[model samples]
Target: MAITEIPKGFKTLLPDEANKREKILTSMERVIKLWGYNPLFPPTVEFLSTFKAVDEKFEEIAFKVVDRETGKLMAVRPDFTPQVARIVASSFKDEAPPFRFYYKGKVFRDVEGERETYQIGFELIGVNEPEADAEIVSVVVNILENLGLKSFQIDIGNSEFIDGVIEELQIPSPTTFIKLLSSKDISGIELFMEEHHISGERREKILTLLDLYGREETLDKAAQIFQNEQSLSAVKRLKEILEILKSYGFESKVIFDLSERKGMKYHTGITYEVFHPLLGCSLASGGRYDQLLKKFGRDLPATGIAVNVDSLQLLLERKGIFKEEKKDFYIIDLKKERKLAYEIAKALREKGFSVARDIIKRSIEESVKTAFGKGYRYVIVLNRELKTPHHIYLSSEKHFPLDDKNLIESILTAVKEEK
Candidate 1:
């Protein structure tokens, strides 16, 4: 088959795209590191049982293979949380409590088209306090703010909150409630209530409460409607988290969603999805999964978030957030005064300037046009004439310089001043 027909849903990232993605990833890593979270990198493949130990349903979406030597089943990781759990259990078993770690890498999943995706995130283990939860949320908010994402909402929810309410209803079939909640199907929940001899008043009230999703007011309404003590306590905890976010001055971006419950089964506490208006879906998502570490024989509490770098790039493009301006530089002559040209380019490069040499034997006009086409603002003409020295010409303005050093410095100064 031809190279063009290699496959679908797999494409290369050009220089510009790659640069933007790198900026976002670097920003996220810097933010997480600032919050005292150290970095860790696990292998891309692990024993299939590692994932299955947490959720058997992952077997279908995971890409499985057989170890040629041991004949053991292995699979590409679909998520980072499970692998981090296994690592903590094996290596850090005797370590101190509250081990915070971060990671950034590619994860594989058999979704609609693409089987591989880039996931940049972190995992905090061994800390279960409310302070730890607040710290995680603060880190997420800071990272988003630093990315220049102005208008986004962090919708926070608690699994125990919704699950406790369903249990308190004493419904004959809890599985139906789980399905209804998972699907966000209010009508299905109503039908289940009607079939189970639940009161119409209670069913309608609960359905209306599920739809009331936004801000701290949602928690107030939830507290009023939920009769279960555990569920009400969950609401209180969410409110406390909101208050902590406010103390960090992130109240404007926080939103409380009581019905938001779409994560892995291990997430037992606060869960959230960060949504921006430009991107229809979430750009980042994560929550507190205190019980996940226990499965690896290391019982501890942890909460963290993962930013979808590619999704973030998409959002930035849609919002016109990141616009890269090309650097201005001069291409020195290769024929006469080659040493002088090299010296000129070296001097400019040391000052954090971009300089290119015309070694391709192209004409001056061709080189100028090439520079302009590549987004360079100015082009420098170099020759061995000191009496009437070389000069820099801007694409926008037509100006000639009398001296070589003055011309080069003028171009560099111009670019710096523009910025």
Candidate 2:
């Protein structure tokens, strides 16, 4: 027989990693709920046409399969926002304005590496005001902080500015130009500009946009260089959103950049990405996609962010942000008094304690030694006498006889006293 092996770009998280991931997700879900966002779950698979319009760029990355029943191309979810849009537009088309939803799930991308990924995200639909944008950004800040990320920054950009620039400039092959700018391929852009006879201030303005990233002053610089209405409007929206975020006391985590033009084809207005020193890539990214729902038959404005849960978990594990609760008590009871020991263990657990009971009977000495070896803080011995069980504090090796009538209370009190 041959050996069985796991496939590449997939991983099974063992206890330690899984535990941390759960804690991070719990904290994020709580923070998201606190901000009045309701939970949402889009299907894991949808027809290929559902994402074909807005997510053409992701077609190569999406894992596609043929549905034998329908004979249509179906794909595992590559992103949640588009699926969310489809549901909101068709399922809740006439529901009303301003729906707030949060989601946590795994998304699959069929690239050569890391086919499966996890994301925690939220969306604010049918709202176009700057406040909606700020709220989404605030939620991201709150979630990262709640997850114990001490140092991180969000770089904000406006898709409108670049789109307006391309339209106003009538640039040929705009997508390729944007890709080159995203990669910061200066030589390629310079050569392209020269080959196209684009020289002097026109070329300078386009090239200078690459360096427009920093504090509030960056917006001023962008406004100065791109005097067109659309570019200036983008700058104006960015400034307004910044002011709103400043009022929320998140100014220190804000950075303005106008050169971020990737992963924003569907984003109509505000776009942002979050970074941390611990990771080479972005820890989270999101933005306003006002035009996304239009493809689904609704014209609701929307903005949201998706945190790379896997990346955040790695950072937290590296920094030791979460620790497993220590096992507190181990119960060893005589055969005849096993029921009483179980009752006591149940009571302790109901009161929010981690209690473990031995499945097999052993001598008091053997049980105590085993509990200590397994790092249990205390051991309780219940014999047939059922009068008082000896409580042994493993670290101090001190013994106390606990009254049976008040066993639960006495054990709890003893543990507290030890602390």
Candidate 3:
């Protein structure tokens, strides 16, 4: 057999890229933690039935394999919210309202384009108030800003309004129209309506949904078009959520889009999509799913947002903001000086310095070149006898000797002075 490739839509991040990814994740964790959101670890694989329980549609997108032990189907997690919901319903069954969780991991799906994606997201569970929705929006803004993303927009919508309109209109096969609306394929929706012989006031009202977007005033225009009480209430809820976001000073970051039903399958109420100019698709997307926990044998309201970590990393790269700071010290240990070099390296690391010991056998000159190439600021050379004052190569081609007793302090002082 020929050599098999690693399959499509999968990427391996080299050390530099991986370092940047970790920095992005760390920044996101810091912001989320500031808001009191604790971390949650959901299993990467779960019973296939658990996923189908929330949305049968997931069966088409989720990857599955038979469990060797149980002889049952297991699914690689396609989404975090469902697994989180399962945990909340079963593990935290007795826990009170308002459980906030933040997660960072890979979600697998048998998608046509990308099979796996990195996601950093948060979930707010057991709250039905508009405040919960506003919190989700605020958290998204905070994370993006903290990550140094200067240009981004959050599009907001109410899935309940779309569902209610479909129910009130008694439209057949609403799913197709929902897809068309999600893509903003207005012409396709019009064609679909025409094909279904849907005209008159009903068709016009459905068409009006596409036009309801942009600033806060759009909510006023939406209320005038919605006839169903549920749809009206959804608009009111969205308006109230916007008011809350406004109070948080994120009003300008939001745009109302009633036609956005992308997550309609599981999202029961308000939905949102985060976009940046660097990518055509959303950088993150999430919404309120009040009924998702019910599938796990509990009733709870929840809202969540999942940031496309890989995409955000790309944005940072394009903006030249994702950079890995250089390591502080690279110590070259001659074969005979290994033990002493190890001791010095350990002590440096204990004092909060990034220290690397060279285990590879190379000449002192080659080791110095390697250290500079690897972006290390200071290079310490241990001779065969491991002399008391080791040779130190400073950044400006200056060479000096640092005694073993003053190694840590001298290196730190040099670093601080350079800074």
Candidate 4:
């Protein structure tokens, strides 16, 4: 392998990709903030003990490191939701209910065939009502809508329903059975059910879960088969969430999935996974984890969603949804008016323009060529002795005077009125 080659599943985002990612993050952050969620930054590294209560699967894929000072093992964060729960449990133990927080950052994991990725997510804490779950669903739906994602489906399910069935039937090693449900293995499920002596009208209902996925009527089918209170309650909760989503006009995008196993042990309530028809993997996934915070110290009911931005970025690129950032300013100072150029650049920056100064000892033609090649929309040439028409705006090939009086204001207006 090359000496500088990064490890498998690690990525190095170049400028254009990073810029696009920043734009995507900004778009998501704006919507999250508008929904009354404040930003919360979790630590990149935590003592391994912090994850003791989380799903055992996280430990297997965690990037572990040794702490030099303490001689203890620490792990780079493999997920953000657990850290959010940790913070709510310990950091804000005394705080009141309904903590709304959003975060966007990198998470490193050792999972094979999966890239270390950037995640944008939000957590709503201290609410156990179905409205809270519905609210988070609406929030993510709004986020995807803002990003112009129309060809996607949010598969919503409640793990409690499935777990309750297992508990009621005394199913052994529930994970194995859950896997069968996830894959819709009708024969495998039948064989497992037979081996476990699980045969009855309920067996038929268990098989029914494999096909209980579709429009709103899918929930009605589930309700008819679920006789147990826990399963019945799940159907009711789903109905409530669906009704709330209907009120938000996002119900059309939801598909009721009764067989989706919860992503983690912490997820105790409604769970959802977002999928795109064009992508083989999930584009986003999250759910309610009411018991996770209790492990950290606080007992709070919370729900959240994490959008797989890397996957979404790729999908957006394929869809050609992003445009080049071409409004940046390029100032070419052929005459050594370094200080004046700096002042102009600063002024443009203060007015919310990204300015780049040409510092190479090149001719005016070459510098302007470089600026245009780099997709800079506005270019200005500086003069040694300031005079009327000494500078030029190359975007329109029109020369504008560089008078000292009202220079910044005139230049700002000369660029463009549109931001």
Candidate 4 backbone collisions, by pair: none
lDDT digits (tens) for residues 1-419 of candidate 4? 89999888888899999899988998989999999999999999998777766877777889999999999889898889888988888888887988999988888888778658888988999999989988888888888889888888888988978877777767797889998887878889889988888888668777777787888898788777766788889889999998888888889888888865766677887998998887888888889998888787888889998988999999888888898777588888766558888998898898788999888888777877888888887788877345464465645455566555777877767765533
How well does model 3 score by local distance difference test?
A: 0.86
How well does candidate 1 match the true structure, expressed as C-alpha RMSD?
2.6
Pick by TM-score: 1 or 3, better one: 3
What is the TM-score of candidate 3?
A: 0.92
TM-score of 1: 0.91
Model 3 Cα lDDT, one tens digit per residue, 1-419: 45756777777888899999888899999999998899999999999999888889888988899999999999999998889999999999987978999999999888778889999999999889999999999998998898777689999988888888888888888888888887889788888989999999989888787888888888898888887898899999998998899899999899998865767478888888999887887899999999999989899989999999988888888888856588988888775647778887898888888899888887877888889889998898766344454777775377666666777677666667767
Q: Can you give the TM-score per candidate against the true fold?
A: 0.91, 0.92, 0.92, 0.90
> Ranking by TM-score, best first?
3, 2, 1, 4
Candidate 1 residues 52-164, lDDT tens each?
99899778889899999889999898889898888998899988868888998888887787666787888777776667777877888888888888898888888887777
lDDT of each: 0.78, 0.84, 0.86, 0.83
Choose 1 or 2, whichever is better by lDDT: 2
* 2 or 4, greater by TM-score: 2
Mark the 10 consecutive residues where model 1 has the least summed lDDT.
Answer: 396-405
Candidate 2 TM-score to native:
0.92
CA RMSD of all predictions: 2.6, 2.5, 2.5, 2.9
Using lDDT as the measure, what is the rank order of every candidate, best first? 3, 2, 4, 1
